[model samples]
Every structure is written in structure tokens, then in C-alpha cells.
Target chain A: EPEVTQTPSHQVTQMGQEVILRCVPISNHLYFYWYRQILGQKVEFLVSFYNNEISEKSEIFDDQFSVERPDGSNFTLKIRSTKLEDSAMYFCASTSTGGDYGYTFGSGTRLTVV
Target chain B: KDQVFQPSTVASSEGAVVEIFCNHSVSNAYNFFWYLHFPGCAPRLLVKGSKPSQQGRYNMTYERFSSSLLILQVREADAAVYYCACGAAGNKLTFGGGTRVLVKP
Candidate 1:
């Protein structure tokens, strides 16, 4: 089965540093999303992208955070300035068609801010 | 508030049967999705049900107020954290806290 791929399985960075997480969604997928989960917590939606523009974003996605579909296949999330609270597992997902069809999630990037 | 609820953990023997439930409060929810996640991994879709009837080891039933995921048979490989998510008209998903299952051999 085709899969979404996320780079940097694990990353450690200073609290004030900038970090970029990359994801390559399925070739045919039209929608991409970024989600995060703090340890032992429920998954939280960050942002959703479609047609090269942000479709929806949660309050957690603030000025420090930005997402871009740099190319047709690559979607990225950049944190301008990281905070200790930013440490979490970030997931990337894609769906060929939304609604009843479930989205496929990548393995995730474990971001640890010191 | 709209939310999904699931047990924190469940334990069973290797060959025992287990049912993991995901109940939700989203009144506009049109579909319920079940996902499996191993430790240190991302969530993987197991099944999705838009209506009360669907096929596969995982099945779902939707009511006016909630939904559920029913796993009929269990195996060692089935031991993983399971999450129940509800998707509304916009394709946004609200996930539960997830239930951690441990299957002892």
C-alpha cells in the first residue's frame, strides 16, 4: 500500500531554535494535515492544507507555526521559535478524498525541545 | 462539547476476545474511524464506518448521539493503542485519548 512519509523520526533542539518538519503525502492525495500529541494525551489538530492553501487551523497553530506545500509532493511545518511545550510527536496525514475514507498517517516525528 | 471517549487501558490473554469502544458526542459527525498505533508510531487506519453496518474485523455503530468500535477476535498482534475518531462534514477528525491494550502470551 502507498504510504505517507515523514522525515527525521526524532529531533532534539534548543528551546528558542527554529525547526522544520517535512512530510511527503501520498501521490494522489488532495488533502494534507498536521497533528500533534503530547505524551499520553489525545491527538490535536494543528492545520489542514488543500489546494496549496490552509483550509483550517486550530488555536494551537499560532504565529510561531506555519505550513507550506513547497511542492506538489512535499508538505512542511516550520516552527519559527520553539518552546519547551512544543515537545511532542507530530504526525502528517493525507487523504485521497475526504469524508468517509479514512486518512493515512505517517510514522511521525518526535520533536524534543530542551 | 463534542468529544470522543475511550478507556485508558485494557489487558487480555493472547487468544481472548476484546472489544474496544469509542463513544462520541459530536452531533454532526458523519463517520467514525478506528486507528491502531504501536508505541512510538503514528496512527494507522483500521476501519471506518459512515453508517451502522460495515465489513471487517472492526465494525462501528452510529446513533443520534454517539458511535462505537467493536473488535470481535483478538490476537497478539492486535495489542496496540486504539483510537476512535469522529469526522464531521469538513473532514476534520476529533480523536479520543486512545486505549492501550496489552495481550499477554
Candidate 2:
């Protein structure tokens, strides 16, 4: 089956540094999303992208965070200034349709800020 | 606030049937989905139920503001963390605290 691919399975960065996470959604998918999960916590929605713009974002998606569909296939989430609290497993997901359909999630990127 | 409730852990011997429950409180929930996650891996969609009936190995029944995932004839590979998520109107999902299933050989 087709899948969403995320680069850098694990990343360690210093606090206050900028980090960019990349994802390549399924070719036919129209909606893309970014979610994060802190250790032993529930998954939290960060942002959703459709038609090259942000459709909706959670409160956790603040000024420090930004998402861009840089190209036809690549979606990226950039954190301008990372903090210790930013450490989490970032997941990229895509869906061919809207609600009621299953979403495909990529193996997450483990972001660890020191 | 919207919330999902589930047991933190469950254990069963291989070949036993396991039923995992996901009770949610979200007035805006339009759909329910179940996902499986292995340690250090991403979550995979196991099944989704918009109504009370859907086709898949994961059976979902929504009643009285709660849903359940019934894993029939469980195997060792079925051991993973299962999460129940509610899909709101805008396609956003609020996930439940996961249930960890350990299958003994």
C-alpha cells in the first residue's frame, strides 16, 4: 500500500534552534496533517493542510510553528525556536477523503531537544 | 471538554479474543476511528466506523456515547497500543489515552 514518508526518524537538537521536519504524503491524498505525541501521552493535533494552505490548527500550533506544502508532494513543519517542551514524536498523516475515511500515518520523527 | 476513556493496559494469551473499549465525550463527534501503534512507530489506521456497522477485522459499535473495538482471534502480532479517536466536524481528531495490549505466547 502507498504510505506517507517522513525523513529523519530521530533528531536531537539544542534548545532555541530551528528545526524542519519533512513529509511526503501519499500521491493521491488531498489532505495532510501534522500531529505530535509527548512520551506516554495522547496524540495531539498540530496542524492540517489542504489546497496549499492551512485549513485548521490547534492551540499548540503557535507562532513558533509553521507548515508549508513546499511542492506538489512535500509537506513540511518548521519550528523556529525549539524548547525542551518541544520534544515529542511528530507524525505526518494523509487522507484521500475527508471525515469517515481512514488516514495513513507515517513513521514519526522523534524530536529531542536538549 | 471532549475526552476519551480507555483502559491503560490489557493482557491476553495468544488466540484469545480481546475487546477494547473507547468511551468518548464529544458532542461534535462525527466519526470514530481506531488506530494501532507499535513502540517507537507511527499510528496506523485499523478501522473507522461512521455508523454502527462497518467492514473490517476491527468491529466498532457506537452506542450511548461510547465505542468498542473487538479484536477477534488475537495473535502475538496483535500486541500493540490501541487508540480510539473521535473525528470532529473539521476533520480534526481527539485521541484517547491508549490501551496497551500484551499477548503472551
Candidate 3:
């Protein structure tokens, strides 16, 4: 089974710092997404990317957040200025079809903003 | 204003079946999904409950406002947090507070 790969399994950063989380979606997948889960909370959608551009984003994805498909296989989420509340587990997912189809999620990157 | 709701935890013995119940308030929801998550790992789609489907030992029954996931003959490895979500507007999913399953040998 092909897997979506994510870098930096865990990261700790000071508040107000910039952070970029990287993901390599499944080779044949067309849609990519970023989701976050605060400790003991349900997962929340952040953004969805398709055709090299953002398709949809939630209110949680504000000016401080941006997503880019920097290359053929790499999709990244950058937080311009991390706040303490930004601490959470960030998961990258990909699907061959629309998101209503099942999505394959990568082992999340734990971001701890201090 | 929670769109999804589920139990907090369930304990079961090995070889027993476990059922997790979920309810949603999203009136426009046409599909539901179930995901399994181990600590420190990404949640994996266990069953897509668009119209009630089964995969391996996992089965899902979906209704307009509620759904349930059944794990048949569960094993120790089946212990994990299970999440139920409803597809909302913009193709995004609103997840319920996950149910943690504890399986005893």
C-alpha cells in the first residue's frame, strides 16, 4: 500500500515563529488536505489543495496559514506566525477522488508551540 | 453547536464484538465515515458509511442522522480511538469526539 509521507514527526517551536510542515502525497492522488487535532479533541479540517491551488479552507485557516504544492509530489502548510494555541497534531491526507471518497492520512506531525 | 456526537470509551474482551454509536446534527449530511486512530498516529479510514458498507471485520450502518460502526470478533490490535464524521459543506468532515476502545485479552 502506498503511503502519504510527512516529515518531522515532532517539532517544538517558540510562539511567534514560522513553521512549515511538509507532506508527500501518494503519487497518483489528486487532492491533498491538511487537518489538525488538538489534544483529546476531534480532528478539524484546515485546508484542501487541488490543481496546485487551495480549493477550500476553514475559518481556522486564517492569514497566518497558507498551503502550497511546491512541486510535483510535495505539499506543505506554512504557518506565518505560530501562536501557543497552534500546538496540535497536523495530519496530511490525500485522495484520488473528491474528499468524499476515503482519504489516506499520513502519520501526523506533532507541532508544539511554546 | 456540535454536529457530531459519540461515546467517550468502550471496553471489550478479545473475540467479542464492539459497536460504536454516533449521531449527527448536520441536516444536509448525506454521508458518514469512520476512522481508527492509534496514539501518535494518523487516523485511518476504517469504513466509509455512504450507504452502509463492510470491509474485513469492520461494518458500518448509516442513517440520515445517525450511524454505527461494528467491529466483529475484535482482537487486541483493534483497540484504538474510533471517530465518526459527517460530510459537511465544502466537502469537509465534521468529526465527533472519538470513542477509545480498549480490548482485553
Q: What are the candidates' C-alpha RMSDs?
A: 1.6, 1.5, 1.6
Interface RMSD (Å), each candidate? 1.4, 1.7, 2.2
Predicted candidate 2 versus true structure: per-residue lDDT over B5-79, tens digit per residue: 899999999888788888888777867898999976768888777667545567788765688888878899999
Per-residue error (Å), model 2, residue A63: 0.3
Q: What order do candidates take by TM-score, descending? A: 2, 3, 1
Give each prediction's DockQ, rounded to 2 decimals: 0.72, 0.68, 0.62
Candidate 1: TM-score, chain B only = 0.82
True contacts kept of 3: 0.63
Using DockQ as the yardstick, the better of models 1 and 3 is 1
Whole-model lDDT for model 3 versus the true structure?
Answer: 0.89
Best by lDDT: 3
TM-score of chain A of each: 0.98, 0.98, 0.98
Q: Model 1 over residues B6-90: C-alpha lDDT tens digits?
A: 8998888876667777778866886888898997676888777667754577767776556666666778888889998988766
lDDT of 1 by residue, A68-93 (tens): 98878899999999999999999999
For candidate 2, the TM-score of chain A alone versus the native chain A is: 0.98
Worst 10-residue lDDT window, candidate 3 chain A: A95-104
On DockQ, the leading prediction is: 1
- Candidate 3 clashes between residue pairs 3 or more apart in a chain or in different chains: none
lDDT of 3 by residue, A1-114 (tens): 889999899999999999999999999999899999998787888998888889889899999999988779899999999999999999999988776777889999999999
lDDT of model 1, residue B23: 77
Residue B97 C-alpha lDDT in model 3: 86
In model 1, what is the error at residue A37, expressed in angstroms?
0.4
Clashing pairs in 1: none
